[model samples]
Target chain A: MRALFAFIAGGLFGSGLFISGMTDTAKVQGWLDVFGAWDPTLAFVMGGAMIPMAIAWIIRARRDTPVLGGTFPPPAPREIDRKLIIGSVLFGAGWGLAGLCPGPSLASLSYGGIGHWVFFVAMLGGMLVAPRLSIRLDRTVPAE
Target chain B: MVMDWVWGLVGGLLIGLGGAVYLLANGRIMGASGIIGGLVDGTGRRDAVERVAFLAGVFLLPVLLYPLYTSIDTHITGNWGVLIAAGLLVGIGTRIANGCTSGHGVCGMSRLAPRGFIATVAYILAGGLGVVLFRHVLGVI
Candidate 1:
């Protein structure tokens, strides 16, 4: 039951990305291009998404466990470490360069062509290497 | 003009609805990066089936809906070097930071979490700066 709901949620999310023009890298890049012919479509998308999500969180506050019987996710992380800032900056640069984030990147895989595959593969490689790199970084820099 | 906004709103609502569904039913945040990242890192190993099911939904829905929507043009960079670099950054950055647009932008901010807000601002600002530097200044992408 939980898995089914997850599947449905994924489908809905993907459908939204497809319908919102978010699956189009050009559209995404256009929104990011503030100095150029900027498109405000993504803002509406973000706003629209926030409404129901905000409501969900409110409901969450009242409930201890979900309908399917699991503890709610823990509170959001609060620490503002170097990894957070640097990673965000790097992610943003990549987002600017390619305009493909994980959600859309996964959703568009079927029709994404060669370029999409390249990004996906490399992204996977990077994810694979990150843990090891972080371990090394941890060894170099004492725990905070 | 108005139609684009409408589409965006409708789409955004669906995305939000999806997040709500996951939260209400499974007691999990529907951040794509975290969902997929956990699977890769073995952090979400206990919930592998759920995550796989979720991803299958994400991937397969478009296949079924392909007929309804207009053909999508990704406009992803063709340059291999740029693509690889961008992919690596996105992967490492999202992993190290523990969130991305969906996790921080939508899920985090919705809950009024400070980390979410900060990460969102940082990424958006970095994205804007990157656009200015790469698109306007470097002219490479």
Candidate 2:
């Protein structure tokens, strides 16, 4: 039952990504192109997405457990650490360069061509290797 | 212009609805990177079945809907080198940072989490700077 809801949710999210042009790399790049022909469509998308999610968060605050009986996700991590900043910077660079993030990238798999495939494969490789790399980095530098 | 905003708003609402469903039904946040990231990193093994089910829905439903709509355009870049490089960066970055646009930007902000706001700001600023460097200064597209 929970899995079914997850599937439905994923489908809804994918459809939304496709409908809103979020799956389009050009559209995403355009939004990032502050100096070029800027497109504000994504801003509207973000605004639209936040509305119901905000409500959901509010509803969640009042409940001890979700409708399916599992404990809700813990509070968001509050640390503003080096890993957060550096990783985000790198992620932003990649997003700007390719105009593809995980959500849209996954949703685009159906029709995405060779470029998408390369990106997805490489992204997976990076994901696979990141933990080890972080572990090494942590050992060398030590967290402050 | 008007149509763009309308479509964006509608689509965003749908995305939010998906997040809401996941939160309500599974007691989890609908963060794509974290969901998939955990599977790859082995931290999400306990919830593997649910994650796979969600991914199947994300991947397969779009294929099913493609024929009916036939209008969605994904302008992914053709440069293999750039694609691979960008992919690597995204994978590493999102993993190290622990979220992405959907995770931190939409879900996190909606819940008024400080980390979400910080991550969002960091990525947006960095993304904008990346655009300036790649598209403008470097001309690397």
Candidate 3:
């Protein structure tokens, strides 16, 4: 039952990504191109996505358990640590380089681009090594 | 415009609504990275079914729905070197940060999480710099 809801939600999310032009790598790159020919379409997408999310947060303030009988998780930590900063930096670099982020990467699999498969596999490999690499990063740059 | 902003907005609303449902139903944030991350790293073994179900829907629906609408192109670069390098960076970065654009950018920022704001800023800035470095300077991307 819970999985069913999750499945439906995922379907909605992926469909949204597809319609929003997020799965289009070129559009993503255009949005990132602050200095060049900037496309403002992503701003609308970001704004559109945030509206319902903000409403959800507002609605949550009045409730305890969700409509589905689950406990609402606590807020994320407030600390702005090195891990968050550095990790975001690296992620952004990759996002700029490939114009692919996690959601769109997964969403683009059906696009049948060899680059997508290669990026997906490579992403998994990177995820596999992340624990060790992050430990090393912490030693060099420190973690929260 | 290459594409319409109306579609972007409509799509975003669906994405947000999906996330809202996930939060309201599962009491979990709808982040692609965290969901997939926990599954991949074995930390989310208990919830493996949920994660996989979510992924299955995200991945498989497009196969059926995409052709129904229209055949879309990813327009991703053919440079394998850049693709590999970027994939690794994204994987490692999102893992370490524990969020991505969907996770931190949408869910966090919408709720006014400071970490989300910072992460979003950092990534956007870094992404722009990367464009400058790769496209303008080195001509790699």
Which window of ten consecutive residues has the lowest lDDT sum in model 3 chain A? A135-144
Q: Could you give candidate 3's per-residue lDDT for residues A98-129 as a string of tens digits?
A: 99999889988977579999888888877878
Q: How well docked is model 1, in DockQ terms?
A: 0.82
lDDT of each: 0.87, 0.88, 0.88
For candidate 3, the per-residue lDDT at B125 reads 93
Instruction: Report the error of model 2 at residue A133, Å.
Output: 2.2
Off by over 4 Å in 1: A137-144
A5: Cα error in model 2, Å: 0.8
- Report the C-alpha displacement of residue B6, candidate 1, in angstroms: 1.3
For each candidate, what's the DockQ? 0.82, 0.84, 0.83
lDDT string, candidate 2, A80-114, tens digits: 77777778888999999999999988989879777
Q: After superposition, how far is residue B53 of candidate 2 from its true place, in Å?
A: 0.9
How high is the TM-score of chain B in model 2? 0.94
Candidate 2 lDDT over B46-83, as tens digits, reads 98999988887888877887898746567776788899
**Per-model TM values vs. the true structure:** 0.96, 0.96, 0.95
